[model samples]
Target: MIIYLLLAIIIGYLVFVAIRIGLHQRLPLALGPISLELIPDRAAKKYRERPIFTIDIPCHWEIEALKTRYIDPLAWSAKRIQSTAGMLASLLQHQFNLQYGERVAIFKQNHFDIHLFTISIIRAGGIACPVNGKLSINDFDPYLANLSATILITDSAAILKFLQSGIDFGCCRKLIIAEKRALKSEIEVTALEEQMARSYPDIQIYWLEEALLSVQKESPAVPRGKDDPLYLVHSSGTTGFPKAVILKNGPQAHAVRGWLCYVHLSRTWDKGFGALPNNHQAVILSFNSLLLLGFPAHWSSSYDHLDFNAEEVMRALADGKFTGYFGFPVTYTQLKEVPAEKYDLSAMRIWGSTADASHEVIQRKFVSIGNAFKAFGIPLKGSIFLDAQGSSEVGTPSVIRYFTRYTNTFDRRIGRIGSTPFGPKIRIVKENGEKVKRGEVGKLEVKGKTVFAGYWNNPALTYQAIHGNWFFTGDVVRLNKDGHLIQLDRLVDVIHTSDGEVYSLPIEEKLHKHPAVFDVCVYAHQQPDGTYLPSVAAALKVKNSISNSLLLHEFNQMLEGKEKLCRCEIMEWSEFPIGVTGKTLKRVFRNRSEQMMK
Candidate 1:
């Protein structure tokens, strides 16, 4: 009798899901004129009328801009974004001689221009490459050359960096400055332009304002087939130098369709905000998804992208009444300490995380603050925290987990692998490609429509990353007894102690529960005997009263055998090496520890 009841429940749930998905598919695509809002920007001015998404920065930055001049932020509305992008695309094609299929590299902080130029380049039948603006010139030089980019579009800060560093322009013949700025330290724009001319005489320099003057009528979008290359984005590069992943139209379109069916249509999200770095692939996905859904989406930033913090994000969410929020795990870490009473976040329905799985500790605070939806005219009190674990190569999330104020699941449980109909086909396989049994840890592999074509310009490395039809995700994971995916650690970061393999994530989770520990990264350190043991580097709270030794002792008491830390170092938050997409660079510390052992 119990078996029959269970079977009936499962079948009913499946039928309901099928009905929801089918209804979502029938919903019209690209419903017109989505509302877009912007938080106040200091360096922006209204260039056109009927601009719903005007730019404005924080008031503190406005005061600083008086001393040091800044560039004007880009502004446009949903109706105008495409038309303006069309004109820009026309300029690139006719004036700059940017041929179809050529690469146009963008080096700028997160703002309206990144999205504008991306769409413009796609419309022109060209591939858009957005480099991480936070990277130093030394780190940025290799990618510029590797891209063989025909055209380069950048902001004032990057222009200043290039002039100071004397970096080569590589294959790029034309450079377009996206904003007008009186160079910092009272330097004139013309003075910097003259310097650029002398330093890079072979490269033609064009100001964005001047380039837009020759604006042609909005040309019809250049037709593209499903497999045509759309963009080139990089992996997070936490382990090493980032790999350039090639994303095509077909895969991205498929992802959009899948999300629309299983995710967006099921939500009552009124306004949304994204705090993830604009260069990340997930940001582009969010931008596309919101635009198609006809939903209002807001992105907040100051003059300096890296300087934008948790406070600014909170301010935007409060002011915009954002119902849905998407960000990386690092962003959530920064927000964990921010008191709920300080910000009006009650309207938030969902706190969505991708790129990495967020800790339950972080989700618990947020989930307690808002209502997900109304039930029979009464609003529920708790929001949903949706965590999806995937990567750039996969193009879409493979595993998804959701936490509410009520969920009992905790610590490294990443939820189920794959979704209905359109999500990736996921597997846990040994190094030799054999499938792993339940509860056994193995490398995660995924096969799906949304996977990238390959790593750009590195076929040898790409070949190694794929086995038959499955793309190796470089993740060490296991299937739990409940059939959910449990994230152990990245394969490279797993500590191989003499006793056994110790996953860093679960150990870090235990440490994070302590009030004094602000942020923690647990990594493997090699001992004198060439064996590995877990070590910790942590940033503590400002008023933390606990001593390092006492904290370490407390942490160890929570752990059983092999996972206990060998050493604990209290470090400043800045001391942790972070990747472009804001993941901790564990390999750097691992390398340093190995050297110390040697």
Candidate 2:
């Protein structure tokens, strides 16, 4: 009897050890041929059960993870994300036949699957091509054809739209539908599936859930050189068709390291939040930064595919111990309407803005909201607003500034040029490549490892973009007496009036300071007499009693010389031509303004 009891005790002890080992097992992640085992940080053990990333979808939105799979898809722990992405990578490699150097086009909305799928693609040795999911079928068809991607990963809305449009699948032989719910439409999922199968009879169709459930051992990561293309990110296409920008393997690592040098990382306990569009370069790079730093972040989707509610964003930020909030300037413009007293924003340490330089008025409002630092263990009541001036071509921020509540500055100064070990070097030069004097606006050119490899499949255009070692940023800027770079305007958006060249941004900045103005777009509009003149379209605050004539007079008073506004149109925010990344499409607006004259 004693021997039997001892044997039972030994077996139980062995079982306990096995369970502990399984619990503490590290997950493997592959970047190129370099395999990295995600070792659990001892200090981060306290946060093991805590959510490292969250996706807060509105109740109205029908997402598969929210409706079917998980009870709480909000809390995606690090282990879960790593393990799932590893599995998905295996599925892509073995099941989907995704080979090294092949492009996997992600044409989905702002869903949680996007992050997983992107990571999986990297692990599987495929080039990730994230397209703007909000584009119409007519607009997106040619882009897919150009990429020649082997796999197309999208959601239900895309499938429904494709069926209606009857566009070919390009070179995409395999389709993986991540979500089954047809958002903003009455089409049934089954009907759409049938239609997709019928339309593309030769192509393979796979559901994301099936891929997730299937078991496959992780494949060996394919080797990649430093110059090998990592991902293909696209330009905003405000100028023309979206050009794919090739982001290479090694330079991206250097770029991330460069970002870490200046950008303040979040503390272990401090959660960050963002509502920026998933496909934007800002979001892609920032998310990568968060993962590398092991910082917790919650990314809320822009439900309407346009913009998120300011109240909802603030509510999410306030509910948790959040330290950061990030979005486009348009979201910040709307956030200005949300009163400070409505939410507890004291926990916020960093309010980050990118995609475009944020307005001074909007920056000041956010800077006054959260704490910059604690005063003797007591939380202070003001935050640091970080405005990072960059674009897809730059790949990383060229200039950055941290605006604290203590500093009351003027003008639309973006920041001083940033520096890192292998970062970008900026120079303001004339049309003939002559260096400009201080306070003289010239074309901005950048030279460094931080610039994107080149525009994909467009050798001629790529050659045109680069001059010697420098890449033209297509922006006009000047250096102030204080050695700060003040952004003037986009080269294309510069108003060539009868008097002289007028910058749109400075005038837009001036208009944004007014109490009644909510949003403003300043551009060169062709008048009836066939001359270009500085014009303005602005949206006013709710219940604003000011008339358009009165506001126009006030705005013009703030401007001087050639920059004076000739035409002012007060329109709803929705009426303005907005780009996918929430940038005001000035050229499109120029065409519309001309049409309005007729």
Candidate 3:
């Protein structure tokens, strides 16, 4: 009897050990050649189970709802997003034969369907590559070739552009036409699937709308480990062809964390509005950050981005319903032109800018607009502006600093964009890897959770950008006495003259302070003598006139000794042409100035 009892005790002990081992054991999940570890939710777990996208999921505006003048009538609830994404994953994997690490290039703007498509691609273990719809067919050709995409999903506008150009979809095996439901009537909608099937007999074409509703298969998200590549985002090819950057899952998650930390989002504030393009990483990462945050923010409607409607956005802000607002500096430049007292913009508590720094004049104007409704005697409250200096590789802003009406101080300095984001450490380093002293200029480098993995298929460029774990941001910055980082210019933007190196941004930012100057870009022009002259082209405020001679004279007086320049041109703000992304084409202006001056 004693022997039997001892044997039973030993068996029970062995069973306990087996159960413990099983709990800790990790399995590697493989989709084709890519292998990922599905770790138990402990750290860096993004959007596992929470409300992500907000609204009715099967989001078609009812015939009655569509009659309303709401710019973007579609909203998607979280469960609807999941089920639609799951169905999409199944269809993409089974029908299109998409595998791990394969590129699926999508040409689209900001819309709920595009967001759903992106989630589906990642859930199906494929890289979602969103092409900038603003790029011309000639500019877009290399990206398609470089991607070697197995699938191409595009909108009607892109298709129309392709038809107008010599570029062909020879590289893509399958095509998806995602017609914008809201803008279908604006363009001449066609039955292109049938026409394309007839012309390209070898390739398959499918309509995105039909598939979303018809595909019944379910494939839930496979937990890809945090470090795996999730997206392939292209760089703005101002200097040359765009480099496709590999966005890793870990950094993608970090973007959500960084934004949450930077802007203290309130659970009560349910709606946030941003008019970013579909390709922007901030918009892409927001779809996943739903793990911690309660509700998803809404994107602006699928209207022509180049022709931005100020009223469409201002009306939304003035309605006093939204909790947050995000836009580019250029957008704010246009917004400040509208009278602040005309609208009730006080409801927007959290406001931020992503691309370029808001001109100090516009910065002060936004704070004033936020505080306009406060009683004349009472102090202002609940308005924050973020000068988020960011890029495609940094996941979110590498530098994030805020200015409130109560906290802001006037300091005449160049590149006062912001400071470090939540998880990254920003350092000003010299070429030799030494940290720069305060008040000295150096290259900006970032080390953190959100730095990108590398440039897609371009290891040489990747190596040049990242040293060890630190990614070298090509931006030039200096540390102020208060330890705040000031953006000077892009390394490429600085030009060397016979006198010395001249940073154009400082010259331009200083000039912008002049009452008559509304907007300006500074570039270097080379003369027949081979000496580079720092030059300025400025846009004058409406009804304010300044002559080119007087402008040059005033500009030269602002500079001392070696910093003085020989040329300046003053024109109306509308005269300065912008790129499709709405950035001033400084290189183009420099070339034109070179021709004119020479």
Please, what is the TM-score per model?
0.87, 0.87, 0.81
The CA-based lDDT of model 1 is what? 0.73
Q: Kindly report which residue stretches of model 1 are placed more than 4 angstroms away from their true locations once superposed.
A: 1-75, 181-187, 265-269, 302-306, 375-379
Off by over 4 Å in 2: 1-50, 58-72, 180-187, 303-307, 375-381, 419-422, 595-598
Reference-based lDDT, residue 36, model 1? 17
Worst 10 residues of 2 by lDDT: 23-32
- Write the residue-wise lDDT of candidate 1 on 1-598 in tens digits: 9999999988887666544333433244422221111201100122223334444441111112111222333334455555556677787888887778999999876665687788778877789998878876886788788888989998777888999998887898888888644333445777877898899889888777666667656555677777888889988887677788999887877766655554543323366676667777877876666555544566654322146477877877888787877778878888877777788887777888888657878988888977664421345688888887889898888877778888887768886766523668999998787898888889989988889889888899899998787998989988787888888899999998999899998888888888787888999999988999999998988735666787789889988888888988888887898766778889988999999976
Best by TM-score: 1
List clash counts for every candidate, in order: 5, 2, 1
Clashing pairs in 1: 40-56, 40-57, 41-56, 41-57, 42-57
lDDT of candidates 1 onward, in order: 0.73, 0.73, 0.65
lDDT of 3: 0.65
Kindly list the per-residue Cα lDDT of model 3 for residues 512-591, writing each as its tens digit.
77877778888777766776778888887755476789888888888877567777877766677665445666777777
